[model samples]
Target chain A: MRRRPGIGGLQKAAAARDQYRLLGENVAKLRTDMMKEQLATFRSQLEEFARKHKNDIRKNPAFRAQFHEMCAKIGVDPLASNKGFWAELLGIGDFYYELGVQIIEVCMLTRSHNGGLISLQELCNHLRQRRKKDREAVTEDDCLRAISKLKVLGSGFEVITIGKKKLVRSVPTELNKDHNQILELAQGQGFVTVEEVQRRLSWTSGRVTDALETLLEEGLAMIDNGHKDGKCRYWFPCVSSVYSSIGSDP
Target chain B: MASGSSIGVGVLFENAEVTTSGRPVLRRNEVECFLLSSVEFDSEDDPPRFTTLKSGNLILTTHRLIWIPSQSNGAVPSSISLAAVTHIYSHKKSIKSMFHSPRIRFQADPGAIVVTIVFRGKGDIDGFLTKFWECWRGRAWEEEEKSESETSRSGSGTVAQGLYGNDGTVRMVGLAGILRKEQEQWESTDKSLQDAFQDLNALMSKAKEMVSLAEKMRQKLLSAPSSQNGSTDDEEMGSKEEMQQWMLSVGIISPVTKESAGALYHQELSRQLADFVRIPLEQAGGMISLTDMYYHFNRARGTELISPDDLWQACTLWEKFDVPVMLRKFDSGVMVIQNKSHSDEEVMSRIRMLVTKTETLRAGVTASDAALTLKIAPAMAKEHLLTAETKGLLCRDMSPDGLRFYFNLFPEIDPTSQHIAKDFGTYGVWVKATSMLSV
Candidate 1:
């Protein structure tokens, strides 16, 4: 209408917009830097908290859970490595390394009984028995973390699931599908009958017997033909309930 | 108390249904039409025999008009079947009516009682009334009864008779006639399939029939083995069993929909979902990823697919109900559904057994290795392995060969005596295996 203030006015408006954008970016950058500084201070405070409550974290499961939660909120993984700030502050790495060694001792001692397979609960119980005088209490989580660190050794130490139970395996025998299936079937009552396996799995008698014999040869299963039913039961000691091993020493 | 006795207040509705979460239970096919919160049931009768029920949720369902108290203050939830609602009083618009909360009066039951529903909460009262009128006039309950009876009667009826039209010409009397009829059926089915694929609506309409057909085929397959005894081969039986399993997983007959459940959609969906997950959870070794469950559940639901947010809300609502399954979020932010009885201790013991095997001792296990051994998803297996590692049952090996787990022999190898193998331990066995590899 009135020449619309021409190109000069438009250039001035564009310059102002660019200045505003730059100002906004500068404010955002400042806020981010301030956040980073606050985060660093918060992390240092958390480290202090962890250092103070180290004993409680080691001894009490509930307290340990809370500590882990705090660490998680701050994106700090105490179990990320055996080196660095966490290990330097708490010697948690050495503690697990010691526990891992003790675990191997127990597993080796009881290898003949369970055939290189032991329940995690039983293993913890054994560790507790061995470390009775130790100030730090060992939980399942602690043992698992220690074991994870032991992976660097290249030993065939790992955990496997059979049915609902978790069993620590120290041997390197490959369990075929049939063997795993049989083990899983035996998990419910600690033993599976040849007939029961055949019926449940819809496998022929030959297949069931062959799988059971392989498990037996592998030392993963024991033959139990003591039942009056005259059916042979394949017992997986690793997955059997704790009651079955009540009288046995770890 | 006096009003309670005068109004025959002792269980007015005999079949008073409530879910584990104390939400009103809906009858099969009896969809909820409308819902109004903070409604009061008042006795407008002259004798004032019926006690006024205060601050309750009034629900209009196809089968019944239910009123449940918000708080359990000695007042029982009551309902008036739509069948009993003889007359609905027309809404009277006046200056006084506008000033007060909206109300709807209706004549109900054997006692000639006039009940007034007072909407005290912020709800679309007009909308509720419209649905109530529509449900009463629709008589959906009668249709449901008719269909249920028809299905039950057809259960024992001959399938062939139903498929063929009654032309009084004995068209399918023999094997040859049956073959010819089957060919004709194939042609018709092919045409219907083409029509179904032409549009989404046609596909949806055909989906129900497809589900029923699958169910029928499954029933036949299930009965086939028993009837034939030793006549069927192993391969035939195996394929038949597989087909039956697929048919069993075909669809959920009545999926909970927002329109059908109204305000109680998520609550009802949660309960239904809890029931639905029982089998799948069992099959997944007591745990399954939330994402996988979403797919399985939606596949079962067919056309009424739910959103991820809806599924999440439904899962979250499980805490309020007495459900066997629960939603678990791992430390890695992975979400899964697992049975309450699925103990981590059990899984840990199994893992311990797997790694200690002679073969596994020489060559460590990958996530896929654990998955195959555990009969579970690889991702789930990795979580289990990580959990096992945390428990010190297994240790991880990260090299060019990728991540693998070994039986934690670090503790067994005395760092002070790294070269010397323990005579009776896994370290000795490992030494022997490695030595053999060199040979």
Candidate 2:
């Protein structure tokens, strides 16, 4: 104000630097250093978060008990709700599974929760327990590209805006036959995170998180992310329930 | 010895005419009938051997006999005309002459070098002789000379109309005097027509003669009304003038035929057809059908008509000549003669603009409609339309209204998916173009 270089000039210079940094960061985050050892840690922490948040279990004890019994019959722990847990259970690391799981979780979460304008970054955070060095923001372009790929690979997921920022959701139908695999993997390994579904549905350039958002828009599953580490999660109500209520995307 | 005898220097052989292609220019109304190839000419009394014209072709026309060097697969075209063949000596039946190339001895003036026609190639001698007799006897030039005399006489009379009478008597320049002269002319014409139709056979033979008669009467009538100071109605005069013009243009310069073109029949016939087609080819806008020209050409030829096969052979001969007109065959098996400079690109561009227009797009265009716009015959216009369709510049709409053409939209249509137009596209233009229909 006192005759230094004008404020606009200073702001422009700062914005240029910030843009350069943002490009570098996004390019770096696009790299997938997917390793079994690294994924095992993300899996256990994500599972613990989902297990600790038992509001649905407390509210519907009969259903929770039935879910556990089903998991027992399937020979998998119901509390193992992390994406890696599901991927290991299915022996897959692709992102479509994570996306499908994320969409289902979002639908479930939206039924009981309201955090206005769910941003992709906030959703991604809810899907994985990220390290301080790994907290990259999800971009609109990233989300768009990922959802497009999920549509191509026959994933029944969608990304939508509720209150403004795009949030992951599921299509109201499971007409996309490949989406049934998501339910199968989830049932076999208890539950999959939104991140796991997103990873399974990876397009040419889509990150795992974008895949999760798309699946939630399609209502084949349900999701939740209100936990300490913000690891968003998904659980199918029942395969028959989703199929009967939803129609295919022509 | 019949060697080099001419009455005077630089006489250059009597009344000889050659074609533009150096074959032989035909007299007006002359037609080529038949032709023979491989002939030599020498003198009966040991003249210098015109040696081995090696397959030289002889042509017989309605008017004169022609000799052309046979165009073997590849040979320089050389020719000579026989308008001066005044007499033919009786052939000597000696054993030596009989073994030689079937030769005929003929006497020609003014040199009177008893020239011998030696047929060195295989051909029908009686056929050639019959045609030679027919052409020599036809005396076509007599008619031309008579016509030319009448033309000169009429030309001189027009200049003499002011003061002198038909008998070269001086007359006063008055309207009444001119009217009396014109009336006398009309009465003469009326008398002739009455005499012409006296017998039905006379009338049939005199159809062309009637045309000439009408021409004479109309000329007489035209001068009459003007001298009478518009005594007759303008409409009657106008119709009469039109009828006269049609009758006057009823004659063709040359016609191709099998009778006149002896020995070299179709070859010379081909050249004559090529020359005669120039005017009609121009009128048809650089292209015309063979069938059509056959009618116009034969009508102009008068007595000698050509068959369709003769016309085709003539057209095919165009490839051998450096003429301006060429024969073109379309994919649909239609044949035509076109100027060498004619281009499909120009025709295609015209059709492109035609189909894209608003009215043409909606209503489409028929071959006749295109012909009218393109200023060409309907058949030729149909060929252009079909070619345009093949190039994908236009598409055809075949319905009860007959086959019509419209601008093609095949390229504009996206076959991949229902990805709608992206603001500026051929599809958008099409939509805007058709939007007027909606409003």
- Judging by TM-score against the true structure, name the best candidate: 1
Predictions: Cα RMSD each: 28.7, 43.9
Measured with C-alpha atoms, the lDDT of residue A101 in candidate 1 is: 52
lDDT of 1 by residue, B1-439 (tens): 6445435644345436775445567675565556677888777564344454678877777778788777777666778789988899988889999899889999887677887888887776676777778889878678668868877876566444222232343354664575456456445544544564354344334533433433433343354434344554564454354344344334454566675556767977897788788787887567665654665675465334565567888999999877878888755345678887785877888888887766677677765467557775444566788889998888887864456788988888777878876767777777776566567
Give model 1's TM-score versus the native structure: 0.44
Total clashing pairs in model 2 = 71
Candidate 2 chain B weakest lDDT stretch, 10 residues:
B1-10
Which regions of candidate 2 fall more than 4 Å away from where they truly are?
A: A1-250, B1-23, B28-34, B44-54, B60-64, B72-83, B92-99, B122-124, B127-214, B221-249, B262-267, B307-323, B331-335, B345-439
Per-model TM against the reference: 0.44, 0.41
Candidate 2 per-residue lDDT, tens place, B8-120, comes to 21132232455565466655455555566677656545433343334666666665555565553332333333456676555467889667778766766556667667787
Query: How accurate locally is residue A248 in candidate 1, as Cα lDDT from 0 to 100?
Result: 34
